[model samples]
Target chain A: MNGVHDMGGMDGFGRIEPERDEPVFHAPWEGRVMAMMRAMGCVGGWNLDMFRNARESQPPSFYLTASYYKSWEKTLETLLLERGLVMEEEIVASRSFSGSTVAGQPLRAEDVSKALKRQSYERSTSAAALFKVGDGVRTRNIHLPTHTRLPRYARGRRGTIERVHGCHVFPDSSAVGAGDDPQWLYTVVFDGSELWGTDDDPSLKVSVEAFEPYLEAL
Target chain B: MTLRVRALETVLLEKGLIDPAVLDLIVEAYETRIGPRNGAKVVARAWLDPDFKRALLEDATAAVSSLGHVGEIGDHLIAVENLPTLHNMVVCTLCSCYPTDLLGLPPVWYKSAPYRSRVVRNARGVLAEFGVNLPPEMEIRVWDSTAETRFLVLPMRPAGTEGFDVDALASLVTRDSMIGTGLPKLPEVGP
Candidate 1:
């Protein structure tokens, strides 16, 4: 969507401040928000792409000001509202008027460990990889409005395929009611000069795990 | 913001959409059980066992799983070694995608705009701020984890620590080193 959230390479954000002895969650509410998001994940209503899209689609003004967990809270609200699990008025009033039936059982406390295990996004595909290691390719000059894993900085840039990561679910297809359309993923490495158009650092290289859909034969 | 979160929780609870006990369990797991220590243990084992290190660089998911440090986000993990001539770092420019199962939740600075926006472009400059001043001859490889794959930097072991056990070596592995922001702590010199 070319939103402000595609923050790679843009300047003037100031210094990186590493907090000393930082806590996992700054406040109790932050933890609660995390739990809520994960719990909703077990409901099986949305995929990870939808969850990310909800957050990235936030208005720039709100997105820029909201804390990390606050953004999660907002994404939760949007997901619930979109799924008809909760209404705007209910969220505002902190009360549920409609007896909406949740589609699936919430994640049980005992199964939290299992739930935290890695989700397998890898899907079997008969399609062969279009590009191999050391093959030169270019990212399509695309500005997709929907959810996409390809970052804005790498678009329209030439790179070399460093490794092929097998077929995985395509986020662009899954985000907006599309199916789990899997595609071949590759690690494309670009020289710093190629991406930034400057020879400031000859030894610097940037790599992105680009889906086949985002790349073009150069 | 807390109030908003609480409000959403209230609605979810009243609608029977979530189990409160589950929320507590999730928080407790992250707060107590999972964290960077898991990654440190993995890194320490790799240092001690050359075969394991090879396996880790080849297939981190299976290698780390053998040690029982496996979980979500840690799947498809890739271990990039920081060699004398080349270094590796990781970032998620579009969002804060991190190996949370292995390293715990990402630090605030990692998710911040400055680090995400600048690290890929000026990695040497960013690493310098973290007290990781690499030489001009060292190549910096910044991996922007824009897909499901996550990255963990296998920092070079410090010199003169030949007999260090896994516990001793794990102690030297800091969270930042695994993330490529800082190097492992050097062995203390006796007076």
Candidate 2:
């Protein structure tokens, strides 16, 4: 099984193979939905279960502000049409879902699903936290996610107490619906020799914050 | 302020699930409303008082709140003083935990993985990046702020500034100096 240190390989820091190119974006409506949820104190409150259930089961979900989504939906539809990723008829059909009926249109679920998946993947992989404050720990030398803050040169190194930043929500695989959970975070301070090996400058030190799960106390 | 969240918003938009404009409004609200301004006052106070400086090294949050800047984290804070013999630097290895009640918003570089990962591993090197070159004999104590405790650095008083009042001294204590990047220096007075 791959470990944290293996991330360098995916990003060409080591010998692991990289994944194929993938770009992701979100549907214009999702932002509005999340905002409205947040305004009701539903995003980070006890109502998480309610929201999650709603997200999974509800259709015609409430949007935060219709005006915000209106312009973005137009832009996204235009882009999809321009890229030939969606047919003119499909755009009209999607618009009709928002209650805007266009002339002579039909929709294909496959095309819309593919576009949504791509956008989701992009959002999920872009999260960067690998550590946090006050964690006594080390970095693993593996890669599995889309983006990481841990560097190739500092993997497997030891470090000490730093800060404990509050949970900022996990973006990595979670953004892509891979089940990565949000974690308490910390930053570890490592000595130069530990990260760079002997002959490295003795005076140097590096500090990086990773999630609680990313570290094992040393 | 909104830069980081906007980046998140962009990702959501790219996913074709969320609208960028809505994310923008949410981010704007967070940046302006829920932002941490209390931290700036403590940082400002640290620059001005000597006794407070002493108090800060002994206990950070209290010393800060004594000057009227309490934080949302840590019920009690432990301030690690940076002396000529021992130098202390703060970082949030897990995320971006900081003594925001004193320092205000963490600089962008502080939030970057490079600073967070590298600072603890090679503290001296990281300090150098901030233009702080520590002597070899001096022991560097890197404080990892996890859990409930928050930390701030009480830098040594600058030379050539003896007898300066608290307000005058505080002006010299810039955010960079407090972070250990630069030392407070006396501003040249007009002739």
Candidate 3:
């Protein structure tokens, strides 16, 4: 989705102005939202890709104005509403819906650490690794409204494979309720000049993890 | 926002989807247990011991996990070391994907538009604003972290600390330094 979150090149936002010794959550609500998201994630209502897509699919204007966790809360609402976990009227009334269908297992307090560490994405398909380190590849110029790990700025650009990360969960298919569709993931390095043209400093380069489907022989 | 979050929590609680106790546990984990100190310790150990550094460089997950610091966004971390010729920094151009287990939640600026959008093309400029003015000849590499695999920048240690131990060295490793936005703290004033 071409949402405000795909902010890779366009400018006009002010200085980064990072806080000194930043906390995990600025306000207490942010932590609650994170906890809620974690608990909801355990409910198996949707995959992480779906949660990402839901946030990315938000109105650009609203997404821009909203804070980070605010966006998460909004996405949580959308997911719950879409999955029939809660009703719209109930949300408006601050009341719990009686017919909510949250039947999946809850992330119990004791299981929080385990749940956080679990990595369920890796799998080996009969498919062998396509590109090796140092192989030249180009990111497939793609623009889709659904979901993609490929950034808009890196699209159609040429890069050299830095490392073969082996097969991992493919986000494109996973976002739409499809299987992991394990694909070869590569850390491809592109010269900044290749991405931003001659104006960019030659000393600059960017590396992105491009799945097999997002690449083609350059 | 709190009202909305509270409402949602109420819904989930009432629906029996989640327990309030679990929410508090998650919050506490992010708040105290996980933080930049974790990454700092890793970086300090790497600086102190060459074998661990090589292990971290070869397979970050196993090396990091051996330290009992496993999970969260550190699920599949790739620790990129900053060297004299090559400088490494991380950003999530698409979204703010970070190794929360190692570095805790990212600073707000990392998720902002300026840092996310400009770092790819204008890393020097971005670094300049962060007070990191790299030499023109040194190459800069910006890493884009994804949900499955997050990247952490193992900032090079500063000179003049010949006798510093891991604990002392870790103090020099700030959060921004590990992110490649700011340099590690300078040597303390001589006694």
Error of 3 at B117 (Å): 0.8
User: Ten-residue segment with the worst summed lDDT in candidate 3 chain A?
Assistant: A97-106
lDDT, candidate 1, at B172 = 95
lDDT of 2 by residue, B65-136 (tens): 566324233333556566778777776554455654345445545544455555555667667666667788
lDDT of 2 at A102: 22
Candidate 1 lDDT over residue span A1-218, tens digit each = 88889999999999999999999999999999988888888884999999999999999988888889888888988888888888889878988997757767778877788777768888899999899999999999988888888888899999999999999999999999888899999999999999997867889999999999999989
Compute each candidate's TM-score over C-alphas.
0.97, 0.46, 0.97
Q: Cα miss at A34, model 2 (Å)? A: 13
Q: Best DockQ goes to which candidate?
A: 1
Give the lDDT of residue B110 in candidate 1.
Answer: 96
Q: Could you give candidate 3's per-residue lDDT for residues A1-218 as a string of tens digits?
A: 66778888888987777777667788889999988888888884699899999999999888888889988889988998898788888877777859556556678877888766546577778988888999999999998878888998989999999988878999999999897889988899999989989987999989898999999987
- Runs off by more than 4 Å, candidate 3: A118-120, B69-74
Better of 1 and 2 by DockQ: 1
Please rank every candidate by lDDT, starting with the best.
1, 3, 2
* Sequence-dependent TM-score of model 1: 0.97
Over the stretch B26-85, how does candidate 3's per-residue lDDT look in tens digits?
889888887788989999999999999999999887898787554334457789899999
**Cα lDDT of model 2 by residue, A1-218, tens digit:** 12221121122121112122211113434444335334322112213222222222212222212222333343343333333434555433332122212222222222321211101111123445454444467676655434344445546777775655545344443433445455655656777577667775565555554555656766
